[model samples]
Structure formats: C-alpha cells, structure tokens
Target: MVGDYQTLKNIIEQSLLTALFQPIYDTEQAQLYGYEALIRGPSNSPLHSPIALFDSAVEHGLLSELELICRQVSIETFAKLGLQGKLFLNVSPMVFLQDDHPKGATLSFLEQYGVAPEKVVIELSERYVVNDPELLAQALLYYRELGFKVAIDDLGSGYAGLKLWSEILPDFVKVDRHFISNIDKDSVKREFVKSILALGANINSKVILEGIETEQEFYQLQELGASLGQGYLLGRPELLPVKILPSVLTTHQRKVKYGNYLDKLASSVFQHAVSFDSQTKTGAIVDYFTQHKHLHSLPIVRDQIPVGMALREEVLELFASPYGRALHEKKPIIDMLSSQPVVVEADTKLDEVAKLVTSVHDEQLLWHFIITEQGRYIGIGSVRDLLKQLTEQQLQQASYANPLTQLPGNVPIYQKIDDLLTKQQAFHFAYFDLNNFKPFNDVYGYAKGDSVIRVLADILQSYCTAEDFIGHIGGDDFIAIFVSDNWQQKADSICQHFDQAIRSYYTQEDLNQGGIVSPSRSGELQKYPILSVAVAVVEPDVERCRSHHDIAELASSAKKEAKKRCKELGKSAVYLCQRRGPDGL
Candidate 1:
C-alpha cells in the first residue's frame, strides 16, 4: 500500500501513527477494568487501517521498526490521557527475537510516562505465532521478570492453542469473538465456550470475551460467567479519554448477594502442630513442650503415621506428682501416650472435628485431635484452637447478618463468593428485588412495606436448603446462592409463589384495577403497578471471576434485565444470563 521501503521507514522514523483506546469492563464490578491500545496509521493515507499498515511494513522488511514505533506511541499517548487502569499493548512474538528489538525500551517509556510496570499487560496476538517456543518463553520470562503482566490474544483461533497455553501460563486469555456472537442461540458454541472456561479455570487464567456487538451476546456471556468483556456494545475504540456509559453505570453497581459458606478444615486452621517419633524420650518431649507453651498436645508418630496423642494436662499432671519426674523422665514418650487418642483425617471438616472433641465424656481425655494425610501423621489440632475458630466464625456470621430479616448480609455474601471462586466451584448468583416497591412503600407506609419484605424473605428461605445461602441486601432486595442442580425449579417456584401471594397485599378494587393511582415524582398523578418480584440469575465462569466483585457486577446486570421484563409484563420475571459449555453440540 505504501510507495516503497523508504516511505515505510520514513513513517516509522517520523512516528506517523497514533493510539486509539478501547475499554475492557469488569462484568461484576461494572467498572472500567483497563484500556487496550490499538495503533492506527495516518488518517488520509492508504495505511490508515492497522491491517493494511502492518501488511505494508511486512512487505518492506520494516515490521519490527513499525511495531516498536507503535509501542512507543501507544505508551506516550496512554500516559498523556492519564488513564486510570492497566494499558494492554499488543506485541508480536517475532519482535522479541529481532537483533535490533528495543530491549528495555518499554521500561524506559514507562518511566518517561510515569506508568507503573504492574499497570501494563503485554498482549501477544496469535497472528504472529512463535516459531521457536523456547525463544518466546525466554522473552516472556524476561518481560515477567521486569514486572509486566502477560496475556494471550485471539486464543482459540490461533496456532498457539492449548500447547502454548500450557508451556507459558499467561495471566489472561482473550477468547476470539466467533464463539461469542449469537451464543444465546448456538448450543455447540456454548459448549465450546464452556470447555474453554473450564480450561481457563484449570490453569487459573482470566479469559476476556471480545468482539461482542449486541445486547443478547453481552448478557449471554455475562450469564455464562464471563467477568471481563470488551466489545462494541460495551465500548468502542476512540481517541478520547475513557468515559463510562450510562448503561454501564446503571448495570454495574453491586448489591449484596448470597454465596455458599466455606467449610474450613482442621488442617487449614492449625499450622503449628508439633510431632515426635515414638522412640523420643519422655524427658525430651516434656522439655520440647515446656519450651513451646503454645502447644496444647503432642503427637507420637511411627513411619509418618500418628499412633497416639499426649494430653498436656495429663503429662503435666504426671510430672507434678511426687517423685513423678524421677520415675518416668527417661522412658520413651510412647509409654505415656493416651490409649484412645482421637485421630482425624486432614480433609475432615472443622465442624465434624469440633463434635469429636466435645463428645468426649471423660474430661481428662478431651485433648487435641491428631491430623493425618492419607493415614499418615501430619499435625495435631488443639481443642482450644478449634473452639476459637468456631467462635470467631460465629461472631463474623452474626456481624454480617441483616438484623431485620436475620439473613446473611454483604460481607458474608462476599466471603461465600470468594470461597467458591478459590475452590473453582460452579454456582449461580441470583439477585431478587421488588419492582414498584418504592411506590408501594410511599402509599402504604413503612409497616406494610416491612411486612412485604419479610414475606418475600420467608418465601426465599422456604425454598432454599441449608446448603444454599440466603441474604437480605436491605429493604426489598434479597439474594440466593444456589449450589444444587435443581436451582431452575427453585427459582420458578419462588417467582410463582411471590406472584400469587403479592395479590393479597392489595385491596379488591386495586387488584381489579391492576395497579394503584399514585403521585408521580413531578406531582402528576400516574398509575403504578403492584409490587412483584424479579430474579436475575448469573452463572459466573469460575475461571473468569477473580473475586466477589466480579460476580456482584454480573448479578447486578441480570437484575436490571429482570426488572425491565417485570415493567413490560406487569408480572414476576426470572431471567438467566446464558452461559455456553465446551462442547458446541
């Protein structure tokens, strides 16, 4: 497209290019996550499009020179804009192997622009597949050592595929948009997306769904559990500074929601358990315990397997007796081990272990529980520590409970989400809110509004099991975290029950009229529909959600859709953000 090599070289030398930025949004937080820097050639020239410009550079043997100039321009322009988030700069793998590749140039530009290394994510597109994996690996390692994050762009469509993903575990992966377009109607595409999500989860990589152009596609991806997304629908690339859209603002605000309670294990809570071989002398064991007063019990192990436990009180009591030290000081520690020591697997739930300690009828034998991994001695868990952990957890739960409804509040809900994310568990986050609730409150007063809220809370609790988490997000908003497979049925039942029960709150005349006559905000009289429940369900991709914030954002978006549906239909609505699986079929 360009005149010749000299012209291409002149373009690079004179920096005849500029950077345009597209924002990447966090589906959970509904905030601007970062901006991706895209390079453009002169607007009046044939090289205006990046594709044509790059092609021209490749033909002229000036690809590396052009790429370096683009990188430099992007860095300078991004800094001038004073962007608040990370800057994603696209780089080709081939440039890394170039002899004249500006090594440390990026770091210098960052310093010149006052940008932090952590705020930059080096995006490697699959277009320039690395012919030498080892060289690319070395280059990536070098960049990582300099504190820059790495991302793989156009992941599924690229030649790199799974092999490159495995060889160099990137911090993020951008899924090609072909899998996202019309995903709501394509079953096979949905399955493929699901598998990619699973693979991302397996590798702990954040997957960003790109090229979304429609509302259905965006919401469907959000429903499928994608936390990071970039598309024309979310935002379009522009030269201006980042400004969040009104739709994004209304959709992203997080409300408290329910999540599964994390059941911590004894092994996870206690880390300072001391153990000794059975042959160790009683005198030495006593000395060790005396030096470590924090230890309440000691485990006697044989071939890494815990055989018995020595209760501190019993050992101290034995030594306290008259001439007790003289009689038993030199004997093997195994001689003093309790005959019926309590043993528990490392994976045993903390609650179960607590029961074991409390069930001991003999107070003298109530001591530490020996923790084992695969039937081998790992450590000892003190009764005191177990009780302490339980008390702390109870206090935390109480603090996070909504006083009016006695449901879990925001903190617990967030903790539950975090726990699920850490364990890579798949679950649904449902946000339920009362439509036209404010109008009802204004007309009927606070007491009736409170009664309505309580009724809704009761219905949610009635349908949910002990395994599910129910939370009150204050006022008429509620949340339910469903871990079971029958969540759809539960959601349906909740909506139906609320729809039928809400009619009782209104008088016969109001019911017949279908709504109530209320004063509009501008003092004009208007008809407001009766209160109805709307449930928005978001099934987050485990791999994409980094924190509870991500899940909360997606749930908020779903809730908005549900509320919209209720406004149009004048009835309770249940909307699920659609998710796709790995198998396209």
Candidate 2:
C-alpha cells in the first residue's frame, strides 16, 4: 500500500507507458487484418500487468489521463513502426463517462501520427461493467461517426458483452481466451465457439479468437470457420508486429462467395472514358465525338472535379443547324452541358446504382452516369451495362436456387465448401438430418414431411448471416457452413427453435404421448420420439478433407453420433467431430 501510491504517481508523471502489437489473422481471406495495440507499464514495475496498471489508474482517480497517454503512445508507436492495417486501441467506457475525458484526444493523437481515423478501431472491453449502457453506446457511436471503427473486446468473458454488442453493433467481436483454450479436446468449448461464430455472422461482426497458443487450438479454430484470430500461435505481441502472417497460415484456395457475394458494383461496369475540360470549345467536343462515333456523352471536368456532361447529340445538332456552326464554334462547351448528370461513387453496389439511375426524372440524364473515385472523375457507365450485369447476376442465382426452399442447391453447396477448402479456410460444415423422419413420412404421408423439411429450412435460413451459407442437399439432409464464431450458441439456438417448431406439426394426442406411432424398419409398430433435427458439425481440415465429398463422409459419421445423442436425449442434439478424414490425412 505504501509503494502503490508512489508507483502510480511515477507511472503517470514519468510517462512510462508503451505499446505492443499483436497481429489479427483473417483466416477466410488468408491475410493479416490488423494489429491490436496492447498497452503495458514498465517491465520491471509491479504495474507491468495491464489489468493491474489500469486498475491502479482507476483506483487513483487518473484513469482518463492514463488512457489518453496510452492512446498517444500506441498511435505514435504504430506509425513509427510502419504498421500495416488497423490499430486497435483499448479504452474503458468509464473513461468516456469522466467529466473531463479529453474529448478528441484520440483523433488528435491519430492526426499527429498521420494515422487515418478509419484505420484505427477503438476497442471497448466488457470486463468493466458500465453504470449507464446508453451513455457508453452514445460514446462509441460518436467515435464511429468520426470515422473510427468500434469493437466490443473480451466478448463471451461476461454477460454484458453480448448486450453491449447488440447496442453498439461494433465492427469486431473479440472472444476471450477462456473459450479458445483447449477447444480442440473439449466438445462443449467447440460448441461455444460455433455459437459465437453463428452470432457474429448473423449480426455481421467479425469475431477474433484470442489467446490461441497451440497447434491443435489453431487448427481447431480454422476448422470452426473462424474469420479472425489473434494469439501466440498466429503471432505473439511484440514492439514490432509482422505485416504478413506466417507461411503456415497462407493458402492457395480460391476466394468464393456464392449467395452472400456483393463485390460487384457500379465500378465493375464503369468504362474508362475520355473527358472534355469545361473550357474546351463546343466545336472541338463535337469533332471528338464524331471521331469516336460510339460515345454518347463526354464528361466535363474542371480542375479534376466533374461539373457536368456534354451530350454528343445536343452539341452536334446545335452546330449542324443553319448558321449553327458559325454561331457557337468558338464558345466554351459549358453552354452545351446537359442538366446535372447522374453522378455515383465508383464503389456503389449495383442495386443502389440502379435506383439512382432509374430515379432520374429526366430522360436525357438517364442515358449515362459519371463514376468517381473519392469524388474525382474516373470514368462513365451506361444504364444498359448496369442492367445487363444485374440481370445476369439474378439469372445465375435463380439457376442455382432450389425450387422448394429457394435456397442454394447441391451445386452451390458443393462449390461453397470446395472453395473454402481450396482456399485453406476453416469452416464448420453441419449436415442436418431429421430424426425419425422416414417413419414420420410413412405415417403422415410425403407432402406433410415436405412441409416439415421446408420449416427446417426456414429455421436455418433465419439464423444465417450474409457470411453464412445454407443449402438444400436434396430432401431431409441439408448443409449449413457456419462462418460465424458464435455458431455453437447458434447451433443450440437452431436446435431450440426446431424442437419447438416441430411440435406444432404433430397431432395433439401424439404430441402429448411424445411421438407418433410409426412403422419400424421391421414393419412393426414403434413409438418414436418427437420430430427433431440431428445436427452433425465438423470443421473441415484442408490437409485431410480434399473436397466437399470428404467433408460429406466426415459429417456422415458425425450425424450417426448426433443421432445416438438425440435418441438418448429425446430432442435435437449437436455432435461436433474432430476426426481426420476417413482413416487419416
């Protein structure tokens, strides 16, 4: 107690804080996403422990000051070391709750280091409970509005983290080491990981698994289809972090996005085109259009800014008319500019560009649109090209979609898994089979069973985020590739929802008795348990599972295990397998 006060005082007064960076690997993309800025006190000091340091700062009534200095050190070090990707800075919510919390200090620090606000992620940990969630949310929202990204750190470490995630909708969710440790040998831990992935997928948050230390744990997460990971296995925290992940983490698989893909946009179809400076003569613009013959309009640029568009036909007709050539040949083409043309950012997706193109009330302006990169004129695109691309995408999707559930069919499901495996990505592939489904079909007829299958499909689809892929693999069997970190919880949620929903299908008497009287395989009467989904989850390994076919076999074995568990429990059950493909890779 005697030494604590002097230590804290010296720590703040001497500016003894420093930062170490830990790389976060994006397994899906097989690239380094960024580094997390971990703050540390002097190595030999008792305050060296980050928790102890921050706790002491809070105890001594200097948390805000300590946090401000920490941010400055992290930003400065990150810049000085020439780090690539984002820099995640931890900030306690209580710091923001302070009356003089040094507003804009982080941004100012960022500016001083020449770090763009968008490249930094402000991480809020759930370890410290907030007295006011609304105020914390507002504070995080303010950072977001200021161009900095927000993340909920230490997710699953406490109950408040989930609630905080729902409120903030942060860009990333960092799972605690407790969940990632020994997950390979622990089925329950694996299930927890699946649940977290599932939740992250549904809410569109990138989940980073922290504290991964062993080869088994690393491979375990990769199998779970984890998107981002940070720990000793990937790369340990150091004063200087590596820009690229180790070769062991690198893969040669093709990047695949089936139903969830939206990379194509207005920029995809934008044509690099010639532009006329606003001061160019009208006659010269007409002459240039005649030389090209195919160009409909020429973008008018003034000082790298798109001001308007000069129509080829409008300019030509005026000059071609009687005495028209002599009347306007020498004047600037600014007069020939049509009403402000449809201008769109190059990266705007097809659907949005479609709306902007169609929403134009004027018929002339609808013909072409200007595409800009960072507000500077880059190229032009025609509505016809945008529509053509949109139509092709829709048709392609429809061709691969199943007729019954309207979900991706066997081709897409296979392709999705094949791509993931080929790219050396880790993803848990769950094969779903309806328990006692055949017997139920025998008793209730085929059509009712089809309805039951559709209901199951809806349940899976409801939980699927854009990152998750759900497909119909023929009839009672379906596949869902969990790209979320919280898939275990989601898998449990899936079982919960399916169990409750299936009860509605059974007649009251049979449901009361707990199942229908169905024909057995031996043609004898059998009292089967209530209808439920038996889900078998497996994280595919690139070395063992060469293709989706190998995954199918692994999942088949897992399904048998799940069926056994379901029989004992008399309800939906999930079985996660960590077996090598067939005999071994």
TM-scores vs. true structure, each candidate: 0.46, 0.47
The parts of candidate 2 lying over 4 Å away from their true place are 1-260, 398-428, 435-477, 480-493, 504-530, 537-542, 556-570, 574-580, 583-585
Deviation (Å) of 24 in candidate 2: 27
Tell me the alpha-carbon RMSD of every candidate.
19.3, 18.1
- What is the C-alpha lDDT profile of model 1 across 1-585, one tens digit per residue? 454677667778999998999988776655678999999888887788888888787778788888878988998998898887889999888787788877898898899889999999998887866788778877887888999998888878878656767888988889898888899899898888888888888889988999988878877776677788898887788898535332532232322132224456878655556678888888788888799897667778888887777767778777888898998889898888766677888888788988888777767556667888789877777777788888886776645766667677887778788998899999988999998888888888889888888778767765676578777778788898899999989888888888887889898898899888888889898898878899999888888778988777787767889989888887888899764122111
lDDT string for model 2 (250-351, tens) is 321112334344337788888889887999998898789889998888899998789998877788888777999899988999876758888889878888
User: Where's the lowest-lDDT run of ten residues in candidate 1?
Assistant: 250-259
- Model 2: residue 115 alpha-carbon error in angstroms: 41
